[model samples]
Target: MSKNNSPDSIIRDITREFNTIVDSVSEESNFIHDRYFRFAFADPIRMAELLTLFSRRNASLKAFLDTIDLSSLRGARENHSTDKHIGSADLVFEVDLKNGGTTGLYVGIIAEHKSDKDKLVLNQISEYYHHLFLERKKDVPVIAFIVYNGEKDWNPLTETHFADYPEFYHDIGYPFKAIYLDVGHAIDDSEMKSLSPITLVALTAMKYICAKAQYTAPRSYRQVHLPLRLSA
Candidate 1:
């Protein structure tokens, strides 16, 4: 493989690119934020790393992440259904389970990026789940995540009412509960220190760009970004 095409090189390049963008931005753009969010997680390895880090906080998710065969990670096909009600997920991945045996079993990880608050975001996520369920024939286990970088405090689960009949809520499971990561509040300096380069850059960029006021990267992050930029 070419030196520049190596995984290490790729991570550095992405970090540098993110640094360049975040350093120069004067105003926030949802489009730019969404694009960068998708770009950072486009690589299966990077996506896996981010999810694995996130799984550290949730025991059940960590167990599931441990079962994944990272080598088998790949981007899932984009939704092309003409149905107006259905929504496409920002990033979706399919990875085989380590104990799948001869037939091979896989699970889906869906990530949705939010640059702004949307009360109906869960509805959109539900649509994505429905679409994936139809395409995968409901056999694949799916886990969903919401990466929110908006300035406003928003929690879809607590803010939105899922159903009128609370009793029937447990019965309807088409859309799984998403683990919400509010970039502004979820990550801290201690957590940042242990993150992989790609995860560090991605989360740092999101936190910096989405802040209510002008923000600066921590000294450690700047030190990390410098080497990446020099290498790139």
Candidate 2:
């Protein structure tokens, strides 16, 4: 498919229904800063790459990433259901633990997304965590992976954001936090010669929230780019 920037145009849904649907795609950038984010990281391979990216940035996460049984990943889920009601997660990941004991047996990554500086909902993430726990009736370890695509002054939610102490707080030796993605840094380094092409693609997509307006597939600068331009 040609790279185009018609946010109004309806793109084909690749999975589920596979029938060309309209208005179901993430096009508008108002209510939600990121519309196409789910599409980008929904794949487990891409998700693994993202986690690997995290490991590269934060050394502590490397150990956590190592514990994840990526081969045992069941796949990514969206809008996962609870026993009584529905609570949607931007992306949900299920993976087994590698030689995990006690709380590390089976794990889940509840990836909540953001493009603006929205704080974590009071109990939304925890609620999902509890729901997943009840379903299995086991001590399931879960990670709240918050992928913030906004370039503005954004940070992880503080302990005050929760009604009570989070389950994983003391276990992880910190307030409940997210596996964060700094989108701006990704875009800035996207042009680096040292990075891989796939990394550039991931970086570019990560910037969709911050630079979506200026991001266009430019064959050139303009008709008067001191000597270059892109024409249809």
Find the candidate with the highest lDDT and give its number: 1
Best by TM-score: 1
lDDT of 1 at 40: 73
Q: What is the lDDT of residue 194 in candidate 2?
A: 43
Give per-residue CA lDDT, model 1, range 79-176, as digits (tens).
32343123368887788888655457887778888888887777788788878776558666777788888788887756526456676564554447
Per-model CA lDDT versus the true structure: 0.68, 0.51
TM-score of every model? 0.73, 0.60
What is the overall TM-score of model 2 with all chains considered together? 0.60
Return the lDDT, model 2, position 24. 22
